[model samples]
Target: MSATGTYNKLVPEPTPHSAPYWEGLNRRKLLLQKCRGCGRIRHYPQPMCPSCHSMEVEWVEASGRGVIHSWTITHHAFHPGVREDLPYTLATVDLEEGVRMLAQLRGVPDDKLRIGLPVRVEFETVKDGLTLPYLVPGEPA
Candidate 1:
């Protein structure tokens, strides 16, 4: 960790195709790629739409609401930088936009976590100029 309370964990390297996604998170907003050809939204931005194989795309803000599709309690940290966050929950969430996102689950207790549990996105700045999204229990907005 740095003096700014930023974690030492590895951060994402933004590419031309995914720059807007990272930029949105830095601005405390969630953004996903919307395929112009198929009118379907997708996460982890790419140059082409997977469904229609079209290069035309646009950026759209996500609602930041989703439900727990699956999760696991991590007793061990794969990276030394995240050792302090051991015993955390990593969840696979099914977003309201029909895309599945994987993020760290926080604020919700283990006993309270279950499939279909509603969650909302919360942004956390882990480093200068970088913010990541996490999930917390809440009603969809």
Candidate 2:
């Protein structure tokens, strides 16, 4: 705890540009930006697609299915908010849309964190002010 009473938690806030993405999260669904021009998918929702540099972008619903590209086992929790979640696995998953995302892994052992592990989306309230979409180990390869 800080003297200022700030928890320094991992809370996510939705901005005017990204509110829809967070809104979709509340519904337990995934949303990504797709280029209306080139049909390319984007992860960090931008005003334009990175490929064709076109401003014609639209929000497309995703399957929320992906595979673990990489992961890290957090043995120590430096922040007070994350202390309760110690030893949790943080994973970077590659979605079928070709976009990579970082999410917390659940329902799996930390020793099992491996590359190319199949994963699925799992939504939960990660903090007081936010409900985030996490990832859980999917079917075995």
Candidate 3:
């Protein structure tokens, strides 16, 4: 937390299956796992396709758009890392690509937070050369 509600450091490790996804983030490009077998895009970058359990997974570029599926305004810090970022937002965005992502929302006041609000993805570089995606509501996402 650099006096900004950007991101906090987690134990950093990128496995082989998830490396490409991280690489795309380094390039400021959003990527998700697209199952080659069933042709469905998914998140969390699993080793096997969720729907079909096939090992054929490919990286697909996201439109970088989504809507607020759900969210919560936090006031407590379970860890020292998030104490400074109190009253921040943690939201689940339902992406247009059919995958959902959990992230913090920025540039919007807390009172304006609502369900099903349109949001668009933007990456913020926190630390360790890691740029994490964030969302802000506007214009149908």
Model 3: weakest 10-residue lDDT segment is 2-11
Per-residue CA lDDT of candidate 3, range 1-141, in tens? 452554555645889999998889888899999999999888888888767889998898998888888888889887777787787899998888988998889877877878788888888777766777877776863
> Tens digits of per-residue lDDT for model 2 on 1-141?
232445467666677768878877877678898888999988887786778889876888887778888888888987778897787888999888889999888888876777788898878754444568888878754
Per-model TM-score, in order, reads 0.92, 0.85, 0.87
Give me the candidate number with maximum lDDT. Answer: 1
For candidate 1, write residues 21-125 as lDDT tens digits.
899998999998999999989877889887899989988888899999999999988998889888889999999998989999989988998899999999987
Q: Give per-candidate clash totals.
A: 0, 0, 0
lDDT of 2: 0.79
Better of 1 and 2 by TM-score: 1
List candidate 3 stretches off by more than 4 Å.
1-8
Cα lDDT for residue 111, candidate 1: 95
Better of 1 and 3 by TM-score: 1
User: What lDDT, from 0 to 1, does candidate 3 have?
Assistant: 0.82
lDDT of each: 0.88, 0.79, 0.82
